[model samples]
Structure formats: C-alpha cells, structure tokens
Target: MRKYMVTAILVVFAVVTIGTYYVQASQETPPNYKLTTVQGDASLVEGIAVYGNYMIKDSTFGIKRAYITTNGTDYPDEKSAISQSLNRRPMKTQLDQWIEEHRQFMRGKTNTSGFYENEEMLAYVNATVDTKRSNDSSAKRNAKLSISVLNKQKNNTLEITSDINVDHDISDMYVQNVQLIDQQLVAMVFMNHSASGFVSEPQIIRVNLTTKEIKNEPLALPGVKSVAADGDTQYAWLANQNLEHTDQWILRISRNNHRKAYQVDVKTGQISPLTFQGHEMLLNNIMNAYGQKIYFLQKAVSSKENIGFAVISYDLVSKEYETTLKNTHIDLSENITYAFKQDHLYIMGYKNFKGNRLYVFNLTSGNLEYEGKVISTEAANQAEDEANMDLNFIDLGQF
Candidate 1:
C-alpha cells in the first residue's frame, strides 16, 4: 500500500511539471509571419517614402530623388522635387538651372549639423488653386512646420505661399517628431540635451496649425527620449526612463483630455514597462509606425552577448497585445532606424555597413519576407577595401 501511494504521488508531480513547461513554452513562441525577398543592384537607400507608384530615396547629397524602371535592369534618371519645393522655385525648371538653385539653398543651410534640427528649421510654404472659385482662386500657405498634402492622386504638387509669421522663439523648442493628424499638424518638442550629455527632464508640446496655437504638456518620466502619436485614435505614446536609473516606461496619453496624464490608460490609455540591463536605451530614438495596425520597437534584455530586437504590435479595436517579435534575427546594434512604407523596418549604422537584413512579418501567411539588407559600418568598409585593392593592382604581363 505504501509503495502504491508513493508511486501515485510521483506520477501526479511529473504531470504537473510537464504541463507547466508546456504553458511557458507556448507563451514564448509567437506565430510566425510570412516573409519574401528580392535582389537588386547594391545601392545604399535611406528614408524611403512611397507615394502612389513612385518611391523617393533620400541620399547623402541632401537631395530627394525617385527611380522607376520600364525595364527591370535600368533605373537611369533622378529629379529634385523636395529641393525645388523648399526653395519656392517652380518645379519645372530646366535641369541645370534647378541644380544651381538647389546648390545655393543648400549652401545657406550648411552650418546646421543635426539632421532633425536642420529639417525643422526650414520654412515650409505651399500654394493651391481652388477651381471652384469664380476667379482662378489661388491661395498661398506658409508655416514653420513641415507640411505635405495627401490628395487622391498623390503626385501633383499644389502651390501656396504666405509670409509665415512664425514666433522665432518656436525654434528654441526642441521639436523631436511631427505627424499629421486629422488634417492638423501635431509636433512633439522636448528639451535639447545633446550638449549636456544627459536629459534631466522632458516636455511635450502640441501645436494646432488650424488654430495657430501651441500647448505644452509635462511628461511623467524624467528622461523622456521620444514621443509618437496615433492620430487615428488620438493617443500619444511617450517613451522615457527614470532620472536616476535606466528603467523605461511607455506612457500613453489621450489627446482629447490634455489635463489628465497617466502611466496607463485607466479608461483608455495603456502603459507597458520596458527594461534595458546596462546599455542606455534612448526612448526618443525608438520609432512607432501606424497602418492597419500599430507597431513599435523596444530593446530586449537577455543573458546572451548579443541582445536582439523586440517588436510589438497592438490591435486598436481589441485593446490587447496582438503580436511580439522578441530577440529575433533583426539586428539591434544600430542606434537609429525607421519603419518603411510597406510596414517594413530599416536601420543604418555608422559609416553605412550591412548590419542586418530587414524582413517583414506577413500576418496572413505566418512567415517573414526578406525585404533588403540594411547598410552598416562593417559592410561599407569591406566594400571600400575590395575596391581600393582592385584599383592598386598591377596587371601581370601574362597570367
């Protein structure tokens, strides 16, 4: 009888342990997404903006150009649209004349070093004609904020100009990210801490272009790095760390009620805790892109030498965590990156090396698609070395 009782106890314990293991494993293993890959000529592409059938690539020369191929092998031409629009010049200027005009505009802006800062400083002016008006109704619009009109066709450029009366002090506000919400331009600005080496406190400001007013809101986290807004839902995600420690938190705010700010949505806002063991994670540099779904990137803490990337997607309607990409194959060594138009993400490291390849998760197929290789410092140096050796080689008389 004693032996039988002992045997029965052991069996039950083993069954319980196995069940626990299975539960833990199931939680960790997320469903895979479909992925695909395409190969092309090795061109370092950055800041991909897709509008209609055209894709614009912003390169090192501070110029934005697009490429299209009638035949698969050839991408032969480039044009300067961003430069022309910024200068208030006619987009149809002859090639040589446009080049000279862009050169002059760039020279004046040469002293600016910070990428985001320079872009924010440029004045944006646009003009549009209202055919419905009895007269050839043309109105000029101008503002200190960056503006782009997304029309049905998406390619036509409308013209507008106004001697934008910007409060020069607005430039003093360190604007981090800007987004268009409900046909109104919303900007997130914080304190500039690059020179100080540390951020003590951060602030968030929202500007209503239609009202021409600015509202400043205080952040709950001390070392707030970045802020992103979900225009569709009127919720803002602010990523920041504690002033004394490295712990990070994602604070969600309701734009509708600017007065009440909470860590998570009690009625509606949601907060998630993110931790980085030793390395300092700049919450500001982290990016969030929206489409049919909302996706954001956070650093994963692991015991392994190489801590990989973590991607989280939240379903707006369900109000639950839809999917997570944790410690995946995506490279995390690079400091800054952006999510591409096709829901693909890309990151470029210093000196432009092939740090890691980008793959998109296809929700329907449950697999990952190989998008393309991200330029990193390591890959760039290797390519340079090979090219230099080829140039230095002396041809043998006979091989």
Candidate 2:
C-alpha cells in the first residue's frame, strides 16, 4: 500500500509539470502566416515593382523577375517588359532641354519613378527651381512643381492628357516621394534657400487630380529621411546629416540619424515629435503607415560597431515608443531590404557571413513570422564584396 501511494504521487507531480510546460509553450508560440519564399535571380537585383499581388524586380543586365506574395518566380513576359522599357528610357522633353540650358535647373532633380499608377492613371510630379543671384549677396529663387497625369488605354499604352505646374518661391526644390493618399496625389517635397546653407525643410504638398490645384504644409524639422502615411495618420522620420562636413557629421552620424520621429497631422499640417529609446533606426524597413502606429527595426549598440537590430513600435496616439524585442544575438548587415504587406513585415539581409537571409515579422503580435535563406550565387557574392554594393527597395507599389 505504501509503494502504491508513492507511485501515485509521482504520477500526479509529473502530470502537473507537463501541463505547466505545455501551457507556457502554447502562449509563447509564434503565429503561423503560411509564409513561403522562392529563389530570385542569382545576379544582383536593382529595384522591385508591384502590381497588386504580383511583384516585378529588375535583375542584372535588364533581366526582370516577377513573383507574387509567395515569392515564387513568375517572370513578366517579353511584351510587358518591352512596354515598360519605353517608360524606362529617357524621353527627351522640353524639361530635358530646359535642364540643359540652365545649370541651376539641373540641380533640381526628381525620382525616376516620380510616376505612380492607380485606378488606371499614372501621376507624376516634375519640379525645377531657378536661382538668380543679385549683385549684393542676395538671390532670387523661383520654383515650379508640376503635376502631370497619363491615362492608360485598353491597349496598355500611357498617354499624357494633362499637366499643371504650381509656382512657389523657394531656392531649391525637389520631389522626393509621391504617394497617392485618400484619392489625392500627395508629394513629399524637399525645399530650401541657398542662403540657409542646407536642406531647409520638408513639405507635404497635396494636388487635386481633377482641378489641378495645389496646397502644401511644411514639416517643423528639416532633413526628413523618410515619410509614410495611411489615410489621416501620417509620420516622418528625420535624419539630419551634413553631407558637406563628412567628418563632423560622422562623429554622430549613426546615432543622430534617426534620433527623432514625429507624428504628422494631414489636416492641420502640424508635426509633434515622439520620444523613442533606440537611435539607429533602419529607414529601409519602415512599413507602410498603418492606423496609429509605426513599425520599424532599430539597432542600438553599447559601442559604435554592434550591428544587431531590435524591433520597436511608435504609437501615434501616445506619441511614445517601446522596444518590442530586445537586441537578439543575430547580426544584420547594413545593407537591409524590407517590405510590408498584409500584417507582415518582410526583410532581407546578410546574416553575418551566412549569406543573405529573408525574415518576416508579425506587426500585430510582435512575433517573428518566418526566417529563411535567400539563395546567394557566386556573382552576387562577388558583387557584394565590392565597396559600393547597396540594397534597394523595389517600391512594390510605386514601380
């Protein structure tokens, strides 16, 4: 009877321990998003273009690779590539001739894909600033920001139907990124006066697609590194780097780059700064602007060299941020590429010397959704060894 009692007690204790272990495991388990990935080109890739669920990437030597959300190969056929080539080539326009005559006008640059497509229309912003110096140390600067629209025909041809240019008084003007927000073409404009001696400020300009009217609101801070918006909730991260003074800049370059993040009000054009913990926020991994939170990867090291990153969240309502994941043992390369879709943030980078790896995180749960290897080839490895290798985001939506 004594032996039997002892055996029964042991069984009960074992059952309790097992139950506790399983409960903890279930609570800590990550979500299953059914994520999958396939091989892209073995050569280096430049940028990515997305058409709904499908993605198009320009591989080495003009080779294009198209894939869906699953990351499987679905190359765009010859006809589609040929059609896009027309847009890719430099089309000689009056703007090009104007740029040639005026060297200052050439300084005002625009993105290659200032054109963004939605609802069968391609919209772009073309900007040029003219600077005329007076005899005394003063100068007169004038800028023109133009909004152009091209209609897509049933035959996949784009024809320019309308163009309207907005006149503004600014020393230098450039269109950084144009986004279609709330049925309007909103452009993130970088403008400054030459006397100011730096990029003065970042402006949010909204264009009425139908009426060709333009209205703008300026951000409080200069050096806007990145900006993302979703409906009314918008935010911009500022990275104040003096490209002129590389040495003094390098003193605080890594730490000062993303030192501040701000919540932007689309209606009022007002910006309020947010307090966050880490400093080295990776600008490339910033996902699309969600409702009231910004999701991004930040790397904070004890010294100047640690490259490990931590995931963090900034709440637009509270205007504060808390680190969701502590710095992991995983080391990340400076060349990181990322994209956000659904509720997942997908990232790719060199996992130390283990070659390039792709990872995804659940923005809602703050759990790592998936991590896998992106097959690297010999040529890609050689190219990456070069000094100028860079990781470019293939603007999934902008193309």
For residues 250-325, could you state the per-residue lDDT of candidate 2 as single tens digits? 0011112333444555444555544444543334444334545566666543334554676666665675776665
lDDT of 1 by residue, 35-70 (tens): 112453222222121111112212122211222111
Top candidate by TM-score? 2
Error of 1 at 330 (Å): 6.2
Deviation of model 2 at 105, angstroms: 24
> Residue 135's C-alpha lDDT in candidate 2?
49
- Candidate 1 lDDT for residue 376: 15
Q: What is the TM-score of each candidate against the true structure?
A: 0.34, 0.48
Q: Which regions of candidate 1 are displaced past 4 Å?
A: 1-171, 177-185, 191-309, 324-342, 347-366, 371-399
Evaluated at residue 168, the lDDT of candidate 1 is 17
Error (Å) of candidate 2 at residue 40 is 15
Error of 1 at 115 (Å): 15
